[model samples]
Every structure is written in C-alpha cells, then in structure tokens.
Target: MSRNQRWDFVRNKNLCYCCLEEHTVRSCRSKRDALLHSYQATEEAGNATTGSRRPPAVLFHGGESSKALFRYIKVQLYGRNCYINTFALVDEGAACTLIEKDLADELGLDGPEKELCLRWTGEISQTEPASKLVNLQISAANQGATRYDLKGVRTVAHLDLPIQSLGEKLIKSRSDLKSIPMPTYRNAKARLIIGLDNIKTRENAIVGVPLEGRELEGDDFVAVRCRLGWSAYGRQCSGEASRPRILHVCECNNGDRLHDLDEAMRNHFALESLGVTVANKPLRSKEDERAACIMEAKTTFDPEAKRWQTGLLWRYDKMILPNSYPMALGRLRCLEAKMAKDPALSQFLMESMKSYQEKGYTRQLVREEIVSNSNSWYLPIFTVTNPNKKKTRMVWDAAAEVNGLSLNHALLKGPDILVSLMGVLIRFR
Candidate 1:
C-alpha cells in the first residue's frame, strides 16, 4: 500500500510499515521472531565452530568488585551486543544476588519492569528520594530496550539484549612499543566480533599477589578465568559508540580497569605464568606457582640493549606448577596466515609475548581428560613448561572453576556485583 493508500492514520503497525501484516508476511507470531531468527543465522553462518566456547566465555571470580568491572565493560559495549546473566555466591550477611543494575546500566540493562535489592542496608537519606531515581532510570531503560535497529543478527529476548581508559607513565608510550599484526579480511563481508573473556584469582579479592582486605589464604580456592577476545580487538572496540568491530574483554578479580595498575600487574602475572620472564631468574620473591599453572616462554628486560631478548623456559621441578594464560596469539597467528597488514601491532604484541617468553612462555590450550567414571564432567587442563621454573602441572578444581563462572557471569549482570579490595591494574591503548 502507498503512504497515501493508508486505510488508517496510524498505519497498521500490526500490518508492518510495508503494509504487510504478520499474517501477510508470514504466519509468524511477530517480526521479532523473524529478527531473532535472522540473528541466530547470522551468528551461526559467520562462525564455523561452536564446540569449545568458539568464543570462550571469559569467566571471573570475585564479589561486588566483579560487578564494577562488568559495569565498566558494559557501558563501553552496550547496544549491538548482549551481556549474559550472572549468579552470585552467598557470604557474610548478603544473599549474593547473581544479577545487578550497575552492570545493566553500562548496557542500559534494567532487569524486570520492577525489581528490588536484597534487604541488607537501609534506604539512603537523599533529598530527591530513591523512588524517583528508580522510576526515571526504569523509563530510560525501556526506551533503550527498543532503541537500536539491530540487523545482520538474531531475534529479541523478552528484554533487549544488553551488554575503558588506562594508566599513564611507568608504561611505555605507543611509539615505544612495537605494533601487533592483524589480518585483513578484504573479501570477508559481514561484521565479525573478536572477543576476550577475563577471569581473576579471587572473587571477593584480587587474584595475583595478595593485597589488602582479601579472605583467600592461598590454602583456600584461588581464582582462574578464561577470557576470549582478539588481541587486535583488545586494543580496539570501545563500544558501539565507537565504530569498531573488534570486541575487547579483560576478565579479572576486581573492577574492570581498561587501565588498572593492579589488574595490569596480574595480567602480567598471567603472561609471566605462561613463561614470559621479565627478570633473568625466577620470581622467588613472589608466591609459588599453583599446582595447575602453565608457563609460556621466557624473556627479560634489557633496556641497555634496547631490544627484546627472547628464549624459552620450562619447569624444573615436578612440585612447582607452571603458569599459563591463553592469548589470542593463536588467533592472531591464524589471522597472520592470510594478512599481515598491521605489522606495527603484530610486532608489538609479539614483543610483549617475547618478553613473556623471556621468562619461558608457551601457548595455553585446553586438554580434556576423564577423571571419574560417571562422565559427569571432564577436566579441562592447560599445561606449560618453563626450564627455569619447576615441572609442569595441570590446572583444574571445583572451587576455582565454579567461582570463576559465578564471578565472571556476575560481572555480565551487575554494576558492582561485589565490592573488592584487590589492587587494580590498567591496560594502556
């Protein structure tokens, strides 16, 4: 029908803007179904594999602080993406709400038309009244729900799918560091997301070398996470606001610090665990490697030489567990297979990896084994060997694993899921 052929003034939205009703277009329930189906197809078609977290779920383990990190990330990646749900573990007097609004906010996520926080604290004595703040936010939330004209993807959920800066100085300037390489998809059409999932050591505290206000005694469960994203994306993709296709993720113990010193330090720890040694000798001054660590190669700082020094390292003792952190270095390599257009970045990433290698580094891959007969679950392991360190070991257990899931998932669902006392780290662009 023509605009002038409108039988009614409001135009039959039920009939669609093209003048085709749901019945006319197809016997589907609504256009949403069609849209959702389209997205599912787009994702599946774009991806050739979906078996091993083709896009690994970057899991974290922490308390409220986890929420803060997720929120920071969400605000940066809202629209055109969806942050999945979270589940919190109980402790102290808190019920451990698995989901939260802080995270929802970054993505303009307002869970449920009406919701309430677990009763623990009293209402604040604000002049405007909390009730009004809640209502206004809810209103804005509703508008955001249908704001984006999503295309080239899937359908809608009951709710619209929801979904950082860094440090200064002591850090190397962009010019100081080498560039990471990226492959060009000159022929590849449709947008592809390069995602990174991060997870920390402790859910309520920092994972790396311990700091203030943490309950983890080193005897209890420490945290471990599996983040997924492209290294190129790690440096790109601020959010939908920024016209970037790469998706960067930093999953750790505390808040999301695009550039947090403490978190960055741990991130280094992760890199080091992979066998990237900054110093010639092992870090005997620091904590021992956990039973399930994977060390990569080894490297050290030689400012005097003004060049990256590289060598490989492996575990020396069976008692010492090597360290390992997964890097899309694997994906970056594949990307290199076709295109090496971004030589600057490719070189930079390799330098960092080389520094990590100085200590004794290697790629971390998932290895599955049957620990029990029931087949209830198979152990997922990553192995690393650094000559300077001890022998290699496997990384797996219930506490760290479950905690990683709960903490990271919570990040996807809250503003400040849990308040953490861990030291923060920042990643520079």
Candidate 2:
C-alpha cells in the first residue's frame, strides 16, 4: 500500500503504526523491544571484541600520502633509577601527558590502576581499565641539566600514533632546516605524548621559525627549534609518502559506571511510599530567622500600585556595599558596542527598557538624585535572546560581583515559600 493509505488505515483502525496492534503508537511495545535488543547486541559485540576489558587500538588512515608534519621531541624519562630515551609527540589538545605502558615498564614505573573513558574521533567513547597514573621525571636528551618532575602521567597500553616517515630530502634541500638536528629515521615511533600538563616540557619542546628568502613563502616544510634540537614539519612533495594523521583522544577519569551502579541500586531499593508523611520539621538557622524577621518588618503593601515593596535582607545591619558603578559602566559600554553592531538587538533592548519604565519597574534617575545617592549600586543589564520564541529579554545581573561580593551576597535569601508538590497532588486527587 502507499504511505498515505497505510497511515490512514492505521489512524482509522486506531492501531499502532509500529506493530499494527490495537493500541496507539505511544503504547507500542515492538519498537521499544527492538531498540532494547539492538542495544544489547551492540554491547555484546563490544564485549566480544574487547576480551581483555581494554579498548582495541584504533588506527585512522589519512589518504595515500601523509604530508602533514607533527611536533616530535626526543626526551629522556627517568623513573625508579632507570632512564629511557624515547621520542614524544607534543599534543596541546590532550589534557594529561600519556606514556606507553612498555616505556613505563622499561623505566620501572608503577602506580595505582585508573579507569579511563577514552573518546576518539566521531564521539566514540569506551571505558578501558588498562591505564594507571605514574610519576616520572623528564629531561631533554640534549639538555639533561634541568630535569622536570612529571606527576600523575597516565600510562596506556598503546598510543595508537600513526607511523610517518619524516621528509629528510626536503630537510636536506634547505640550508637553514639542515643545520638543525632533525629525526632522519625511515619510520619514527612516538611512544609518549607531551600534553599541556607538562608545562616546562611543552615550553621547551617546539618553537617554530620561518625559513629565510624563497624558502619562507613556497616551502612545504617548516623548521622548528626545540630544546633537544631542531625539527621540521610540513607536507612533502612526494606522492608516495604517507599522509600524516592526528590521533584525537580525549581522556575522562570520572567513573561513570560506578555512578550508574550506585544510581541503579538506589532506585532498586527506593521507598515505595508516596505523599506527605509525619516527620520532624527541619530547623532554621539564625540567618534564616533574621531574614524572615527582616522581611516581616520591612514588607509593605501598596493598595494603589497593587504591589508589595520590601527592603533587602542585608547580611549585616551596617554592611557597606562596594563601588560597583565602574564595573557596571564597563559592562554597559560593552553592551553598547554589541548593540551598535546588531541593530535588531539594539531595538529589542531599547523596547524592553522602555517597557520597564512604562510599567514602573524602573525609572530614569535625575542628575541630582544620581549625585546625592553615594551608596547606590548600578545593576548591569544584558539581553538574552530566545530564537524559538522570537523574543529578547533584558536581565539585570544581581550576581555581578565586585570585591568578592555581589547584590546576592549582601542580601539574605528569604524563607522558602514554594508549595510542596506532594501537597498539590494530594489536593488535586
């Protein structure tokens, strides 16, 4: 049958489109069962592939020729009175430095096992239990005088860094690039990744400089100066050369599985009873009592305005507010600059402020009143746009702080006046 005819038949029969059952689509069990089965199959397949409970080493191939260049430096890792010289890749994207497990083992490094959730390209994440935080000292192979301590460096079974041969011929052609000591090996293996956590290592690792004369503009290779020596990075002219590919790996240390299990256990053993039950009332603090008393004393109802005006519940009776005018003025200037660029935004904000004045929510302060009020605070206003609603709202920033204190900090939060959900449900019933 045609799509429209099938849909019409299901609607007339008041049957589920998913299962062709008596119930509607909302009550269809077939779709839910199919989704559950698919999830289970995926989980089982993942488990079958990762028998060792470790994520399999993922390799990404970049076209035929790997012309791109990566920053690699030779560093000597010292741990447990053993030192091993290895090439390390400078990856600023990685949060923590990672060393190969074999390299860590060779250096006699051992630490507490850590569970990590590693996410690769395409948002594919897997929980692997084959990582540990190890402490080691690293120094440049050329400059061994300054040894930097690297603490909490994670050890992984494999870095999954692609093997790319450096462009030696290109390096030899340029006089300036050839002067620096660059890696000339056919296949260089980077066993360690120097991340931002190793600040000293990163600072001394790679420093780029433009080549002289014609080599600066048209040259494919760029030479970088490192503490260990010089390194060249750029695309090679040879089509046969493998194209360099970057390994995008993100490490998450938060134990999501344990948290999930905890949540599941809590749900399984949750209290079955519903609605309000007899229980001791939670005691209010001295500050809460003071806030309540302050509100009770200062609150006044205006019959003409049909609104209640209440004084702020100040933390201290004689609390001195900091001068926030400068900050507010700076914020206002920034808003004006933004509004100048966006005419629609400017119109929306002007309309909102005009509405506020018309509704008596705010008023234009006279020059005399502005000068007279020494302790007055100016709230910085900003616009929040809702694209779905096609609306823009002006928000007064009460939490914009100056000297570690804001309008919210000075004023005590009044008593909770929110009605209980259970009480409302019981009343409805």
Candidate 3:
C-alpha cells in the first residue's frame, strides 16, 4: 500500500495482528464462544442424564511479577463505557474485591452505601471504615463486560511496585526517547483491584508457583512478600532509623509456615507505628514502664450466640479518664434515686449486674454501704431484642448523652470492653 493509503488504513480500520484480519484485537471471540457453548451443552446434557455435572475450575496466574497480571479493560458504569487498566491481587485472605475510591468516582460510581472500619494485613491500626461497595461491568479488551462487585476504599493508594535499578533506568530512557502511544501508561495507575471474593469462580485462574509442584488443592492460595516503608524529609523525621521492613502475607496452604510467621510477628515486640524497636532490657522503675494501648480490633458477630468477638487484651492500667465535672460537687442528678423510681429500668439494671457478675466483668457486692462519690457514673440499662431471635437482652446505654455529657471515654474504650463482658461465648476465635 502507498504511504498515504497505509496511514489511512491504519487510522480508519481496526486490525487484528494475530490473524491479520480487519478486526480489532480480541474482537473475534467465536472460538471462545464455541467452546463455551459446547461446555454448556455438555453440562446440560450431563445434568439431564446424571443429575448433575461438575464444573471445571477457572484458573489465573500472577504472571512473572508478584502483582497479578494487568490488562487494558473496559468497565461499564451507569450505562456509560469507561476504559481503564485493571488487575487482581490475590488477597486470598479477604472476602471482597476493593477498589480505590477516586478511581470509582472517575468512573461515575456512587458513594458508599455505608461505612465500615477494617484492617489490612500487617497494619497496627484499624482503618476508619470509610470504604463503600458497588457493582460494575468489567471486561477484557474488546470483550463483553461482566458484572463485578467491589468494595471501594478511600485509602487504597497507588502501589509503586519495586523494580530493579536497571529496569527503572530503561523505562525512563524509553519514555524520553520516544512518544509512548498507550493512553493508560501515559500516567500509569491500576484503576481496579479484584480480590478473592470475585475470584471464586471457575472463569478466573491464579498464576503462581505451586508449593511441592502439585496443583492447588482446597484452600490453596498465593502469597507474595514485598518491602514496605517510608520516610520524612525534615530533620525531625529524618535518619536511617526509619528503615523499611519486609511485609509478607500467606493466606492459605502453608499452615505451619503461617503459624510460625504469626508467632514471629507477635514476638517481634516492636512499637511499629513509631518505628521503636522493643528491647528485652527491663525498665528500671514502675514510672519508666509506659502503658501500651490497643488501637485496632477485628470482631465477628454471631447471631446464634448473641455476641461479638475475636481480639485479645493484655495487662494495662484500667482507669477512667479524669472527670472534668465532679458529681461530688452536686452538679448532676443522682441515678440511684431514678432507678428506684422506675421498676422496669430497675429490673434491667439488676439483670445487667447479674450478667456482668456471671461473665467476670464485675465482682458481686459484699455489703451495702454509703460511699461518698465524685463523678458517680450511672450507666443506664435498657432491653434490646435480638433481630434474629425473639429473646431480649439487657443493654447498657453507654452511648446515651447524659446531661449533654458522655462517659464513653471513661469506659475501657477499645477491644477490652467487649472481651471483658462476653465470657466464653465471646472469647477470641
């Protein structure tokens, strides 16, 4: 073809390089469709004759890179088409796919329906539950899109996958030497990240090196380790003391390895958030020993047991925060007198006391005595019916605002409160 004619052909027509056809790449899915149709027909025939047909497993690979292989894909949101890059991270540990909120916003996804507090693996602090979930259509290049449900988090940032110094230099040189053609790589960032929840299908495969050279069996999942750390520029935050550490996650198959790793992580005993390495040296005095606070917790609610659980609390000073307004000053009304006046509330209080005593949360009173008090915190009690059951349980109104003041902080504010109150039924799982 003439130069001008070739240019016109390239610009005007979609060319398939694989088959040297006049269709865009991946446009011809006849082979795939035919295979799928044949499989479906066989499945149907088997179901009719043999009562059921076992479906084949769908597999995916993580490619040579630890990150799951990425592809240029088109996503449909609100009936509009948006082409973006996507990849899967085999968070075989987590149950749901999570997308970056900004990427979702660009794709015209609505705000999260509700907020949830959660934690990522190796995180010392539980993240503020700011992620929302939505469903969208995602497809491989030139293929029909499929519905994919994902949880969207505002905190999911661009992962700077580490590369060799030589690789980095080559990429920079290539960018400088020529005009990069792909729009996606101009400012490359993965827009979508699929997780194990959506990956439970037979259609997707996990590309990975199998342990023991055997195909993955039940609960066989992939894990990868990467270096993670950060530093600040100013003198206040500078120094090699802020060195990064290896963050590794193995979700499945390697039970012994996971157990040992978990034990090691717990024993590392370092103040991770501040980068302070914990030492075996003993503190010289009680005054020198600082209290450790629990900041994050993961819990599972059981409707059958009527409880919430799964966290441990170590020894720490159990004290309420100093009261700003003293009750001994006679600024607040007496709750003892109020409880006596209302029989229903009084009974609820008695039941709560009994429950607390039974669960080892509180000790039974030895004798009734008139004790003078400052800031006499009177936590009111109420009956809460379990939605899944007809049974009613006594619940203290700790969140209630009393005289425009709250004593929620005065109570054990973290996982300890839950751990203390719920007995064996709520022990850490």
Residue 295 of candidate 2: its Cα lDDT?
Answer: 89
Q: Between candidates 2 and 3, name the one with more favorable lDDT.
A: 2
Q: What is the lDDT of candidate 1?
A: 0.29
Kindly give the number of clashing pairs for every candidate. Answer: 96, 6, 12
Cα lDDT, model 2, residue 167: 59
Task: Write down the worst ten-residue block by lDDT for model 3.
Answer: 227-236
lDDT for 146 (candidate 3): 49
What is the per-residue lDDT of model 3 for residues 1-429, given as tens digits with 9 covering 90 to 100? 544565456556655434445777676654422211345667678788866556666644333322221222223333145645443233344544556666666676655555443344445323334555566545433245344333332334333322211123323333221232211222233444445555433444322112221112332221221110010011111112322323222222245557988888766644443665545764433322322133233457778757866543323345333343343223224545656787876777688788888875767445565343544455554566678886667665656554555566444333222323555655433
- What TM-score would every model get versus the actual structure? 0.14, 0.43, 0.25
Model 3 misplacement above 4 A: 1-83, 86-90, 121-123, 143-188, 201-429
Q: With candidate 1 superimposed using the best TM-score fit, by how many Å does residue 147's alpha carbon deviate from the native?
A: 21
- Candidate 2 matches the true fold with a TM-score of 0.43
Instruction: Give the Cα lDDT of each candidate.
Output: 0.29, 0.73, 0.42
lDDT of 2 by residue, 93-120 (tens): 7777788898999999999997777776
The numbered model that scores best in TM-score is 2
